[model samples]
Target chain A: DAGITQSPRHKVTETGTPVTLRCHQTENHRYMYWYRQDPGHGLRLIHYSYGVKDTDKGEVSDGYSVSRSKTEDFLLTLESATSSQTSVYFCAIRPDRRNTEAFFGQGTRLTVV
Target chain B: AQSVAQPEDQVNVAEGNPLTVKCTYSVSGNPYLFWYVQYPNRGLQFLLKYITGDNLVKGSYGFEAEFNKSQTSFHLKKPSALVSDSALYFCAVRDIGIPGGYQKVTFGIGTKLQVIP
Candidate 1:
């Protein structure tokens, strides 16, 4: 798991409710990413953080937001949850070595009703 | 835009037989390719990567991928398939030259490899 943890492994929420997923890493890696896994879509990045406070949107950033108050924690928030947002969310840390594969955390399955 | 493509939705191979999972990429600049395997209900595990130097990069679990610049491919191969090798495989590509901001790492739709025993 590379010291990465995603909280609330499984959750079911009502539509239009606010939900936030947490990604905690002890690897001290500089790069942290938020991704969602869905059918027909391998893993789409929602957002990523380069440093403690530096963050950027990914390809599928719409309807979602991320915040990184500290280096070890990266949070993904869905302001208004929808059925379309139901999927498995994964958090990953880019390896320190250049051009290497990133380490992933156990996914959090979120179901919107 | 940089992207990765896994043409096949699934690949099936018999135990002890050779197996190949195809992957191709389209990138603006020099491509940094990678392969990751995901077991059922588990996180993705890094299998191998092709940055530069050698065309054939060997990785964990006796898996290897060949980088073909002309074909724009980095296909994952294994000499002998094991039942344990049955899992979902994903190919990803990212540009090395991007500095700061969103270093977009695009992933393919993933191929499910089923090794029958």
Candidate 2:
């Protein structure tokens, strides 16, 4: 409801194949994040972008990459998918303010076979 | 490094009874704490936050959280429970003192709440 949209709400891919999840925002927030949710693990950060073209790895960034070419779009790429990588992926954005709450988009459920 | 923990995996309560979902966090300097709730097949929504000022903060859906600095805890509470309140809840924290620390909010393993009628 924060003007954030995630594409391909559900996806299945073969193991070792490439996959990308897209997050688009209309709020023009300076921060965007990618996270994966798994049972017993809560939501683990995959990657995040603080500003256009500025990105950083998160707790579970291995085997995943992200790119932010413009303020409106951030892409999460799985260079080579694996069964262990199957999880619900969420994209979030927040205003630059220090205490502003982060808003989330509908999650993407990805499966690797 | 900043982290949050929700010790309970699930909590059960009867309708009209008071309910609480505990959360503890660790971070350097002053920590900004938050609580969010998620319904079935939906994204997480902001419930409340503890930024500064009052130690007691209230937010959406009649939920409140008490921030205890010495204990490093921010536990979500509700006066009376309802069946509609059943959902997964998460606690998060970020370091407010650092300028770049606000970019990400680390989450705890969610606790599923079941309110029975």
Candidate 3:
């Protein structure tokens, strides 16, 4: 459970339109990540934040942006939606300790028409 | 760069039979490996992890994984399969070898396990 929640569990937006997905966590973990899940490709990391206002790009960060202005929220933004951007997005958080595993939110399904 | 590979796309086993899902990893230094299972339309659930210590790590739901440093592998296994065990399994890795701080985790493409009745 890990006290994580992903808002807009399901969404559909027009191509070339702006979209944003939100991830909120109550555990107060220092690390949060955004990933997209696609068939065969598995989960691809889009971006991550190690601390409030500190962020970094991931393997599939192109065409996507993220902001973590506060410790509890990490936002993923699609500058201009594309059909290729349609997928199930997951948000994860892990403790600062090195030995522990990350906890995941339910997930957000976004479709770009 | 750290990476994980799940060589199988799918595996099937009859109920009560032993099952295994393979995973291998590449890291510049030491590694911290993990296994996760996902049911349809659900988020990933942690099964087990290989941090430090024993090579054979056990976790939730009758799952265990063997970590072999020489082969660069961490394969998940269960003694007996249950129909309820059918799901998508993911193997993930984090490179502790990376200096400075903890690195990001990389997950495998996933292996679908079908436990037939």
Candidate 4:
């Protein structure tokens, strides 16, 4: 209930198709991140944005891309989805403080066939 | 690199019994630790955090975590386990002094706690 919402809560698509997940936050937090959660991998950061148009790669950034054109919206896109990319995606936001807690969205469950 | 580890994959406890979900962390400098819980198909919800000060940090839903620097651990504890407490728990850490203005929280694989009736 952090005013964070992830769209397309469930998605299923074929491999080689494009997929996009959207995260919207009303808190106006300075940092936003996209993460994927697998059975044994926990939650791995794929990409993050500190500000509008300022993006950076995370530990598992390969085959994933992110964009933040405004403070409230962050988008994660997979140019060509793969079966390996099938996982539950979460979006998180943190205020501009060193030890501030991060808030998470409900999560998007994506499956690639 | 900053990291967190939850040693147990699952923990089982009967209602009214004391319960613990262990977590340990590694970081070069002082680390900010946190605990979060996730219900099935839901997002991770903040439980507690250890930023500084006291070693015993109390969090939401009758849960607390003790930060033991020497032991490199922040184990979560609850005096009594409730059936509702059954959920997946995650521990996370971040270096307090990491530069470049990005604070990435590294999470543990998560431990599933089942409180039986």
Candidate 5:
């Protein structure tokens, strides 16, 4: 509801293949984040971008990478997908202001075989 | 590192009964707390947040969370539960200070709330 959209609502891929998930926002927020949701892990941050070309690793960034070339789009890529990388991915955006709320995308369900 | 904990994995309540989902947080400084709800197959929806000011914060869908500094807790509450209220709830926290900026939020494992009809 916050002008956020995640492409490829559902995806299924085999192990060792490359996968990419895209998040688009219209709010022009300064902060964008990629997160993965597992059954017992809740949601863990994978990567975040403070601005275009400015990104940082999150708690769970081992198997994933992110790029934010423009203010509206942030992409997450899994170089060589594995079964353990299968999860629901979500994108979040927030303003630069401290303590501001973050908005989430609908989520992409990725299954690796 | 900032972290959040939702002690209960599942909570069951009858319709019209009061319901609560517990959450506790740990951080270096005063933490910014938040509650979010997620329906099956949907994204997380913002419920409420405790930035400053009043300890009692009211959020969407008749939900409220009380921020207790002494206990380091922010438990979500509802006066009467409804079948429609059944969903997964998550608690999150962010530290006030970080090198780059406001630290990224850390979410709990989530609590599944089931309101029986």
Candidate 6:
């Protein structure tokens, strides 16, 4: 564990409802990322933040938004949840160094019905 | 953009037998490669990484990976497989020469390793 915690390890929400997943890190790393894992497709990056209030989208960032107000917290928001958005979400943190590996949280399993 | 690929969906190996999981990557410049393993219901754990220097890199849990620049591959190897080694493995890559303040690591689809007793 790299001092990372993901809230609501498991969640269930109705389709079209709003959902937010939180990732909190204590390491004070400059880079943080949110990813969704699905069968047949490993881990797809949803969004990543290089610094506070600085974020960028990934390959599958559609319908998903992220906000990093502080160094420790990175929030991923699903404006309108859909069945396709149901997956295991992971939050990762790493130092500014490129050669370093990223540390992951336990992961959040979300289901949209 | 840097990308990684795990061609095999699953690999089976008997206990005490050598095992390998394939991974290939594409990057324009020098690539930083990594391997991570995930047990059931847990987060991914870092296994090893290939930054530079030697082509062979060793990491946690008796696992090693050979990085071949010519072939564009980084294949994980183990001298002997154990039942406890069965898990989902992921290969990730980060391109250092990318024109950006941050280089995101892209992961492969993952390969399931089953070490039979």
**Which docking category, incorrect, acceptable, medium or high, applies to candidate 4?**
high
**Candidate that would win on DockQ:** 4
Which ranges in model 5 have alpha carbons more than 4 Å from their true place? none
Local accuracy of candidate 2 as per-residue lDDT tens digits, A37-86:
99998998889898999998998999999999999999999999999999
Q: Which stretches of candidate 1 lie over 4 Å from their true place?
A: none
Clashes by residue pair, model 4:
none
Tens-place lDDT per residue, model 1, B5-112, is 999999999999999999999987898999999999889999999889999999999999999999999999999999999999999999877875556788999999
Task: Between candidates 1 and 2, name the one with more favorable TM-score.
Answer: 1
Give per-residue lDDT, candidate 5, residue A94: 88
* Fnat computed for model 3: 0.63
Cα lDDT tens digits for candidate 5, A65-101: 8899999999999999999998999999987758787
Q: Pick the candidate with the highest TM-score.
A: 4
| Ten contiguous residues with the weakest lDDT in model 3 chain A | A94-103
Tens digit of per-residue lDDT, candidate 3, span A1-113: 68999999999999999999999999889999999999988899999899999998998999999999999999999999999999999999988747788889999999999
Give DockQ: model 6: 0.80
Candidate by candidate, in order, the iRMS in Å equals 1.5, 1.4, 1.3, 0.9, 1.2, 0.9
* Greater-DockQ candidate between 4 and 5: 4
Total colliding residue pairs, candidate 4: 0
lDDT of 2 by residue, B1-117 (tens): 888999999999999999999999999879999999999888889899998999999999999999999999999999999999999999999887677453567899999999999
Q: Compared with the true structure, what per-residue lDDT tens digits does model 1 show for residues A50-104?
A: 8888888888899999999998999999999999999999999986636768999
TM-score of candidate 1 to 2 decimals: 0.97
lDDT of each: 0.93, 0.92, 0.94, 0.94, 0.93, 0.94
Estimate how well candidate 3 is docked, as a DockQ score: 0.72
Model 5 per-residue lDDT tens digits across residues B2-116: 8898999999999999999999999998889999999999999999999999999999999999999999999999999999999999999988866555477889999999999
Candidate 2 docking class = medium
Off by over 4 Å in 6: none
TM-score winner between 2 and 3, please give it.
3
State which docking tier applies to candidate 6: high
Clashing residue pairs, backbone N/CA/C < 3 A, model 2:
none
